[model samples]
Target: MLVAGTTRTAEIEGISAAGADSDLLVHTPSADAEILTYGEPIRAPVVPVSPSGCPTPAVVTRAVRELIGLDVTVVDGGLAEPTGAPTVTVGARPGDDVREQDPVSTAPGVLAAAREFGRAVPDDEVYLAETIPGGTTTAFGVLRALGETPTVSSSLPENPLELKQEVVRDGLTASSLEPGDAAGDPADALRRMGDPVLATITGLLVGLVEGDTAVTLAGGTQLLAAAALARHAGVETTLRLATTSFVAGDESVDLETAARALNVDLTVTDPGFENRDHPAMDAYVAGEAKEGVGMGGALALADAAGVPMEDVRERIVTVYDRLLDGRDPAEPQP
Candidate 1:
């Protein structure tokens, strides 16, 4: 179709109301990013800070879609039925299966669009891509609720058990609930967040794999969570795309843990980043980096896309700095 589903998280820590719509996602959209919403949101991701420590899905989707030249259709994707996104039929239920369009879960409106491109130009391999912010939080919530170990503990994870527990703890705290990390079943997690953008991406993964032309997952932790779900459901796939590889084993976001749960072979290029953001590094160390703002995953996607990493980094950091430090967002940067 035009492109895969384009999703943005709405999370503003201070005022949850801010995330009640796609405002937060639009807050940090890429230079070419567009804003498409139906009306308002109910429960969305909220990032109170201006620089938006996390990369909004709005920004990531716009950038990725621009690079690949795909039309973006924004869906509310709020907890309730969405009215913003284009109507794409996902003629299947949400479960653990590498389903083709013939039978799949949560299909984006664009899949049918992409498939047509394939038919017209069968020679060229075309597929879907996605971006969702604040998804890792949902992942943690899902796994912990499912009673499985979550792997995204630290901004950098070393031990999965500890990491999973930590993520569970944070999620529990954020939701103002008691800490729980008991691995029992997946239904709990799925009921809580399985239907999120993660579900859509997993659907994309299966949708692309069964037919032809590999799919490229364009974000981090959330991709790992989706991959893990695929593995757990016994979906067989070999993510051949470089972007796919980057998500399966990234230490930065518990990709391995997510993959382990999924039981698939989603490999990644090592040391995913060619350059380091000392300032961001300092922020993480200073305990400032928040999940779902989308810096690491955006950087990873930039890497997979072969773009100048600094340009992407500068856009994010500069935009954020100007917005947060009371500088004019319209002012030019040095």
Candidate 2:
């Protein structure tokens, strides 16, 4: 089973280039969760896409889920709109911009709720995922608050490192925290500089740590931020991270170094989108909407299950074609 959380942070602008435009960005997370549970998004005619028309990674994740028969549970960490899929909500409101202090004022309560929610799950092994617009920026804020100079990735081909750094700096300054000020207190860092998704994921990881169930933190820098917080809060459990080759191959950031810093075992999967004929796949090869909604983890799991990448690609094409035509995929392709 995969537990995917959705959130929103106002710092998405100037840092992330996820949705097709500013108006669609806030709907990205909800649309992603809806697409994962149902075959298509209920709120919009098409799935969210990058500015270059690269479909949201939710298509990839949806393909893998149908191929492998994986069940998904959506977590409403904080959504700007409601998802058609049922959700376990941990937060009652969306997060404010990170540039302001106390972005997630209900951090402690949200964490506690997420911890309890995690403990209630019956699965022995789980894949954790997230769908948050501008999540990387908030992750950077939390990481910086905890004293780590993390080189996080962006949804766009160009990393926008300077913009992210500026956002983090403003967030820290507004929160009155210097780098490392919240080092020993992980939850405080989240409260001061993070989003509901970070707190929820951190608490979920911590809750799973106390049990025998194995957990894989899925996604790139965002998951790293959660794991870093979990460890800083004294979670001794070893974590496994899964992401796409796009993130691994990004020259603008050092993902491996950050994984090593958190002592996490990293796995990178390539869905072989290179040179694909589809418009969305073409944009993906060009480096847009690289990883989100657990695409990397779902791809890795499919590979382990002896599913061919070609099959996954075919499924994605089917989903994308239907999406473009304003229709649902009704059923998985054989």
Which candidate has the top score in lDDT?
2
Scored by TM-score, the top model is 2
| Each model's lDDT | 0.37, 0.80
Residues 1-334, model 2: lDDT tens digits: 3334333454366666667776667777887887888878886433688766678898999988889999888887777776787888776357788887777888889888888778777789888888787888888889899998776788888888888888888888999999999997887898888888878888788877766669998788888888999888898767999999988888887889988888999999998988478875887788776788888899999999999999999999887876667433222112
Taking the tens digit of each residue's C-alpha lDDT, what string does model 1 give over 1-334?
2122222222323211212234543322222122212111212222222242422333333343334344443322222322223534433222221111111223333233333333333322432333333444456555554455565432222323443345445545543443243223232344333433455545455545555654544344555555555444445665422232333434455555454555534434332223555332233333332233223333455566787645554454543443325433233212
Candidate 2: list runs displaced more than 4 Å.
Answer: 1-12, 44-46, 326-334
TM-score of each: 0.50, 0.94
Clashing pairs in 2: none
